[model samples]
Target chain A: MKTILIVIFFLYSQVQSVEPDEILADQELENVARIIGKELRCLVCQNEDIENSNADIARDLRILVRNMLSEGKTKDEIISYIHSRYGDFVLFNPPVRFDTSLLWVLPVIFLMLLCYTFFRKKH
Target chain B: MKYFFLLIIMSSFGFMFYKGLKIDPSIVPSNLIDEETPNFQLKKVENYPLFDSKDLLKKEIKIVNFFATWCGPCKIEHPQLMELSSSFRIYGIAKKDNPQNITKWLKSYGNPFDKIGLDNDGISSIEWGVYGLPETFLINKDNKILYKHIGPIMKNDLEKINAFLK
Candidate 1:
């Protein structure tokens, strides 16, 4: 029983493993797609807080971005397209409105509070 | 200044093209790791009379390598695989590759597999988790996979495979 518990715990920790078929995805093409996608000033990436490292999986997301671009999809449509496939994780920068308003506003409000406190004390 | 900018532009584009050529398109995704080893039962290429991949239940650590006669990496890695097979039971997946070519490859490069299976249509390779001409899978004797190498075998790979076999 203890052995089984330990084994289960070990398997649980490998959270980033890929499926065998998933290994068949190209790494180079994916990398090209990701760098272009995340850096093209998605406004969404910055708003949503996406980074620029271009990890392999992020590269996959990049390819999807290019495919959408080739399809002649607009920027807004592209943002939504990624959102639908990967959920909010697709956006490097999140938008300030709608279901994600708090993600955007809370930080701004906190900064304002900090500024107000500093200025008030100075006064 | 204009010439320097033009040089930079030309070099950048040239670098991309050179990188593309260096990058073999056969490389698939990293997603195939940690999944089940593709199931197969191909006849032996050396001794076509023999059979193999049936010991999916054993505790022996195994590596199934996909190769073709035309693939450069396959030729490069063949010698290393031959050396490793003395300690580890390596299986071969001939990716839509013919028996004559495989036999010739073995004759020149050196044969090391415990058994070679035919992935004739290139479709079986998709199941066994092959992305290119010379991908390798390190499968535990239990038929479960432990790791995968996407490109040619190198010294680092040999050490890693040895560790896994251990």
Candidate 2:
């Protein structure tokens, strides 16, 4: 019984908010939509990716992604299309620009400081 | 020298944290500001004048308001829209709302829209990058989006809107 419950719980974790009608008929295209959906942040929910979010805006975005995919829009094209409309905020992975460079740079600097303090001679 | 370097890093992190605290994370700055309004054709709402991207090019500053009859904040901002309509052309996009309901709501609130468009499926709202109801965008004479207000426009917001108009 415990093993069955664990299997059920594992299956539940795999469930997503993509409705039946929203899924593309083409298997390859549906995979692309799923991948893109995971990368795009739901603007309304803020933290959750559109693939998992149940927000109204997330549903709209999910349909939009499928529509764009069915229309033969490439993955990059679809992502950029939404990005151009909603800006960097919609992207889960922020582009490294001058404004956001600190996010990438600060971590490396902190790591270097830790290594130096830990490995350096104490004399 | 080690102590000085550590202090510098700590102070920099402290300053960054202080700046981050002052920012309201909910307000996502619009990427469309200064960009030309996106192309869209909204169906006419009831008997109101039709609105489209071409209407945005006219030689006058205009306001594009994304609202819904179901949204409570839209009703709250209705009075401000009425006041603003006296000075600027206000275009309304009723997102995913029934035309009859919109007509009744307008009658009750007193219509402030110079032209009202029906965004029946909400595609137009997506084109405008609207994630929430009662979003307002101020467009300049050249059709560039000048400013965007996310929520209901309250009494105090009038000054900011007026300043943007100038």
Candidate 3:
């Protein structure tokens, strides 16, 4: 019973929103689509990735990603295409531009300060 | 001096969080503003003539709205849209909606669109980077998208829309 429950939990957690019709026949291409989908933010949901979102836009994006992959577009090219259309908000990991540099640096700065404050007190 | 630096850093972070709290994260800014409108030629929902993006460039300014029959907010926005129609060249794109339903809905709600495009596949909405229904885009004669308003347009938004149209 415990083993069965664990299996059920695993399957439930792994469930994705990719509909059967959207799946590509080529396994390699499908893998690429999955990777791309995981990276693209669902514009409607804002917090969820397109791969697991049930929003209509997310479904459109998943289909678009699969189509692009089948058309022989590279992963970076696909990402750039989406980024160009949707802007920085569509990216789960925002690019380090001048404005975004502070976002990337501040966490490190905070960590360094915490370490310095702790070590200096001990010494 | 070190304590003062820590205080400044903590205060700045606090200030940033306070400002961030005021912003609604769901309202992502459109990248298409000031850029050329995405070219599309969709069949009219009922009228024989198709809606070509080229036609939008002929006017001084135009409004293109993405709506669906099933959307509740779109129904709410219809009357205000009708009020704006007399002054603006407002075009509609019925996203993934049946023509029959749209025709029926228009008849019941009152038709505000100068031209209604049928976006059955929703490809046009994707090209426009439309994530939500009842989104409106204002474009100039140059085909540049001047503004994009997501969700339902309210009374306050009319002032802004008028400013752009003017």
Candidate 4:
């Protein structure tokens, strides 16, 4: 019974915010949508990706992604389209622009500083 | 030297906190700023004629406010909106709201909108990239989006909006 429950929970985790009607007929396209959706953050929910968010805007974005896929748009094109409209806030991993470069580089610099401090010889 | 380094780290955090306190998180910067406004067509809430984005191009500058009857922040900004309407051409977009509720809300709160559009499906709001209710967009004469306000309009916000108009 425990094994069965575990299997059921695993299966349930696959069910995301995408509604039955929103699924693309093409399995290949649907897979692409899932991959892209995981990368896109839900602006309203902030922390949750649009793929997992139940927010109305998330649903709209999901539909939009599918529509763009069916229209033969590449993943990059679809992502860029939404990014242009919503800005860097919609992207979970925002591009390393002038203003956002610090966000991406700070952790690496911090780690390097820590390593240098730890490795430095005692005077 | 270690104590001096610690002091620098601690002061940096303190400075960050001080700056964070000065900024309002609710006011998210819009990507549409200085970009052309997205085109949309919405039916008027009343017996008025259809309103389109093209109509706004004729004006030197205008305000496109996204609101709803169900939104609390929208109510807080109502009187301020009414005050703004007297001086500026403010077009309101009602998101996913019942027409009757909007009509009633307008009656009670006092209608401040010069032109009101009923966005029953919320597609237009999505096109405008609205994060939440009570978002306002300032559009320039060239159809470019000038600025965006994300929350209820406060007294300081009124001054800022007025400054932009000038």
Q: Which candidate wins on TM-score?
A: 2
Tens digits of lDDT, candidate 1, B50-100:
335466566777777878887888888888898898888777778666788
DockQ of 3: 0.73
Cand 2, B chain, TM? 0.96
Backbone clashes in model 4, listed as residue pairs: none
From the highest lDDT down, the ranking of the candidates is 2, 3, 4, 1
Question: Which regions in candidate 2 have their CA more than 4 angstroms from the true location?
Answer: A1-12, A121-123
Give candidate 3 regions above 4 Å deviation: A1-13
Put down candidate 2 lDDT per residue, A1-123, tens digits, no spaces: 999999989988765999998888899999999999999998988789999999888889889999988888999999998898889999999999999999999999999998888877563
Error of 2 at A19 (Å): 1.0
Better of 3 and 4 by DockQ: 3
Tens-digit lDDT string for candidate 3 (A1-123)? 999999999988865899999999999999989999999999878789999999999998898889889899999999998898899999999999999999999999999999989998999
Residue pairs with colliding backbones in model 2 are none
If scored against the real structure, what TM-score would every candidate get? Answer: 0.48, 0.95, 0.94, 0.85
Higher-TM-score candidate of 3 and 4: 3
- Report fnat for all candidates as fractions from 0 to 1: 0.00, 0.52, 0.61, 0.45
How many residue pairs clash per model? 26, 0, 0, 0
